[model samples]
Target: MRILTKFMLGLMLVLAVACSRTPTRAPSAGPGANPQLGDSRPHSWTSGSPYGQAVHGIDISRWQGNIDWNRVRGSGISFAFIKSTEGGDHVDPNFRRYWYEAAQARIPRGAYHYYYFCRSGFEQAQWFIRSVPREVGSMPPVIDLEWTNSKTCPRRPSPAEVKREASVFMDIVGRHYGQRPIIYTTVDFYRDNRLGDMRAEFWLRSVADHPRVRYPGQRWAFWQYTGTGIVPGIQGDVDLNAFAGSRSDWVRWLNTRLTR
Candidate 1:
């Protein structure tokens, strides 16, 4: 019986390997490039590795101080999501500088707000709206929902409450920016909030494995794949992200979905 079982397992493994090697579609111009970014290549981490053909991008806050946007643009970075605000009052000191510099370098840039569980979502949304200017060619706003583990504001609301608040924030921001906002969440937060049902696009955080492997059936507009990414022009580790499609798709999204 044991010998037979082993033989069957080996056969299944062989079949799986054979199936994996089966040809699918022709290589994209930027095969594995982020479909949304319109590049058909894999990300910096996955290119030439086991995971190939994804476009690459990065996210930054004040922690990555004094970035040289010109060098970053030259580093094959397709886009950036800059941290704009948090809670109801705090704005990242570098938000203005990063936003302007990224534009000057002609890098497509967007702003994200870090949600504070302790505050009302409306208050936070107002803060974000006041801080981030509605500009042409800017990607839709992103609401980053996660556990801060902070001592002062550590309230974990019920899933219903989380959803309600998130909806309120997204709706207001969406109206202001004239684009449907993207929701960025950690795996735990997503599961806790039951975010699968939300209508907005998602930006999922998964570092150890691909979003497909970890997230299963969930569709994400952006994948925040790593927080320890080393990029030129940035002094230290930075968070990296990938759009869901190719560069052309990215352009289409900008044209059709990103404006009033």
Candidate 2:
């Protein structure tokens, strides 16, 4: 409880700083990966330190700064999720380069399609499926559903609508990807869409709300606990995330599914 509270306090500071900071390094290059400033430690975490065993990966879109795959691999990066497309027609230009680069670098990678409430989820997912080919080694695709475009009233879809749209995308991508696609969401968006029952691997965002564990009583494979992270091989700054299980879990999961 104490640890969680401390993280929340840190979040309050991060949000304030992120407002003025230009989002030059995020998936979409705008509000999606805004850096949280003002925190005592710009890049810090309360992780229990997984003894170099757990899976370490990153989720990137166009706005997510410059990434050097070689440098990242040197630092023990095992996997990554690159944003491929958004809405039904807008595909990320950086994804094509990054996806192939990661694959060439011999890294386990996955592609994600951001769902736009105003567009068709199925179409967006299909677009991603088409854009990102089924490579020899590929992680399942992901659905990124978050409030967008500056929280505009008309632009923001209703909570109910978001849920329906998310389901549509999930189902479509799930069918095409051959596995359950992961769902990436923040606390606010997750609650608004009631995503707990969606039935897929969850990638929850929690930069500061650590010890407290915001997304309680649920199964999650990845927890993005920090956005104020500065990593080598990535330009400017980047978000940091960690897997929820031990090294054994990683080896087991990979051997079972990716060993084909």
Candidate 3:
């Protein structure tokens, strides 16, 4: 009788330990679940991957070339950021076509400007405002900041100078569009400029791992996970991004974040 009692106690203890070690299963169709996610050159991420995010998107420039907006929308793309302007005078050749087609396809689209170190922020902001139209139901504009190896403009200003220029640019653009701008940046540029101190939503690029691993505690709204992405409408490899929320959360964000 005593042997039987000891065996039962040991079994119960073992069961308790097993239960403690087992992790609870997350909801299959809840927030952070994305069954439609795909990649052309997928990475083998061990942890902190953005593929689990529910909302996915893409960013495009003239390099993408003659996109079929309808096909892109059908491919589970929730949003898009089209490159509009770069430097002070240069405008993307395909911006107008992409913008119009994307709107016709009913995809939530926004414009982005590539920062030019040679020009003043005010000039760049005005250039962006001239190029991109402010329309209702459009996503907020984006300012992409990154280091360049341009022979014409090899200026890498101090962090203070970069922040000052960014502030000038964001202030002017935000006021003109009636919505705050999103800052898109790489890990090195973000770290060098200490962009975490800035008061704007960030779109971070981290292709190997997750943004958390690269940016480290920095809050981001969008994560660009892969550059060699295969979408239906785009001809060549495209940059793939994911929103940091669920489908419901995306709806809420669009409702509140879109230009009035």
Give me the candidate number with maximum lDDT. Answer: 3
Task: Estimate the overall C-alpha local distance difference test score of candidate 1.
Answer: 0.74
RMSD of 2: 13.5
Candidate 1 accuracy as TM-score: 0.80
- Per residue, candidate 1 scores C-alpha lDDT tens digits across 92-191 of 9999988878776767678999999888889989999999988756778999999888898889999999889988999999989889888999988887
Can you give the TM-score per candidate against the true fold?
Answer: 0.80, 0.75, 0.86
lDDT of each candidate versus the true structure: 0.74, 0.63, 0.82
Give candidate 2's whole-model lDDT: 0.63
lDDT of 3 by residue, 185-231 (tens): 99999999889999999999998888888999998999988898888
Candidate 2 lDDT tens digits, 121-236: 66776777778776534677778877776342236777777777777777876666677678888888887767787777888887655523677776778777566555557765
Query: What's the lDDT for residue 85 in model 2?
Result: 84
